[model samples]
Target: MIIQLHGRRHLLDVDLDIDIEEFTSHVLFGPSGSGKTTLLRVLAGLDPLDEGELRVDGKVWTQGSAIKVPARKRDIGLLFQDHALFPNMSVEENVAYGIPRAKRGDKRGIIQWALTQARAQGFTSRPVASLSGGEAQRIAFARALARQPRMLLLDEPLSALDTPTRESLRNDLRLLIHTSGIPTISVTHDRTEALVLADQVVVLINGTVHQIAHPSTVFEQPADAQVAAAVGVETASAGSIVRRTNGLAEVEVEGARVFAPEPSFSTNGVLVCVRAEDIALAKEQSVTSQRNQLMGVVTRISPHGSLMRVDIDAGWNIASFITRTALDELELRQGSTVVAAFKAPSVHLIPHD
Candidate 1:
């Protein structure tokens, strides 16, 4: 299905166009209050487009001041962050809620199939309140799938769980979404969630569509400083292209030169973007295949989840993530001198205005 939407609603000023192929997933990704959920609601026909139009498969669902189709008729399977199950209902009953009364018997097999596909079949007879968070979410997913809607809409479906539960469910959710053979549009503010679930990512920021591309492209080669900041590209330094040879460009950032694959756009000045996780640190100038190595003093060390973020002032500021074990082994401390090394391809340059 071809979906096109151009409109303004609340804080959202969106112009979105995409094709929904079978078994594909598109993620709307951004920070909080960026209108990701707003756009999803618009597509689901819950929020009318205040000033424009939304067309699905060339059929108008909303135009100017009217919603041609109501939310109930959209045939969309929606899964919310909270999993909104009925506490009094058994897992089986919750999954059967959307089926028509006349056809409930005919759809029983489908309910069982969905429960099996979601890995929630074992607990079908249990009350919703008795299920764990992960199990409850699985039941919710089964309920969404049981209806066999044309497309699925997930609004931060896994965000409410604890870290371990959320991480474990990520893979399961992706697998089930694909297994259902339904195109999906999911909204997420978490970067890793977008990376894990998105075939295409629409990067929204402050009510505008900043960049729309694959997850890798959105994270690695952000279109502008706004996108770079939003996607957590930790190191960005303004640099000038000093030379171009054999498709590689030499960029000078604060008197330090680094080789990078030439950017597609022709610009003398570019923003050098390096992900902290892509950098490697060494106490000495070790001989390795990495093309860029700059020596500097470690200015700060901060805990980042299971790793430490080591900030180095190597002409320009550079951040490298190392495990706690490596941190202890390397003896990295504030004011420790170290060499930061990273591959040439790891440097993504955005054209500077």
Candidate 2:
């Protein structure tokens, strides 16, 4: 195992128990104040723990013995949101700065390799101030990789770029990082980035680790209502398990019958989550393979950049996503009667109080 934290307490009682293997990539994801950054700082040796043991690759980074390794000697690379390149240096020089004097003869080759990997090969001679936002961000990553550290730490690396640049750079960065075969722990609030890059995701909430799992599993089966809400599944409604058979469970939500798969709820007052994308909108009751269906009216339409969010009133408000083309084709407007259908496997059951 590459990382282990035990008996830790800071702001909250953080008794984190996780074991990640080397060369595995994962994301520390949560809301702004969810301690994602704090956990990274702890791993980077920037924060002191009240009580815990931290081991990286079997080397004790921290423990009750008061033996804590310093950040500089940890041989970890960090890429911050802001590209903190020196204004006076060129891109190539910035990356070369991290190369030790013993390897100074190979500085040109190292810089070339880093720039090629980042797809910033042509911008090497450009002054730091002369490069575009995306170019500078790539150079920052190049500098970090120039050190060839065992682990890399990233803090919202794509948050500063524009949408187009962010998208392109996200793909390039993921390819480069995986090719390097180094264990990486990245912190990001962006769900798309987490889904695209992480093999596993660690959700932090209020100085504690809430749940850790694969990206698909985390989104499909959130550990609780709070975690579900954090990931954009926000509607919380009471329901009861009416029947269970054939790997499916019938849930009655406010007198409406909805089918879900393998629902573990045994009593009343259970909360269930259904993603907006999972809910499909239709003009009438149509024959399909989907198991859950409800009659609803279009209550509101919200435009979200490239997507349209349709709010349906089905005894309770249910949100659904539709493409602009689909919305226009359906001629969907306020007060339109629509049928909301979703697969039984997509409706997730969250623990209810």
TM-score of candidate 2 on Cα atoms, chains taken together: 0.92
> For model 1, what is the C-alpha lDDT against the true structure?
0.89
Clashes of each: 0, 0
Clashing pairs in 1: none
Screening candidate 2 with a backbone cut-off below 3 angstroms (N, C-alpha, C), the clashing residue pairs are: none
Point to the candidate with the largest TM-score: 1
* Candidate 2: tens digits of C-alpha lDDT, residues 34-57: 777767777777776777777876
Clashes of 2: 0
Please list the C-alpha lDDT of all candidates, in the order they appear: 0.89, 0.80
Work out the TM-score per prediction: 0.95, 0.92
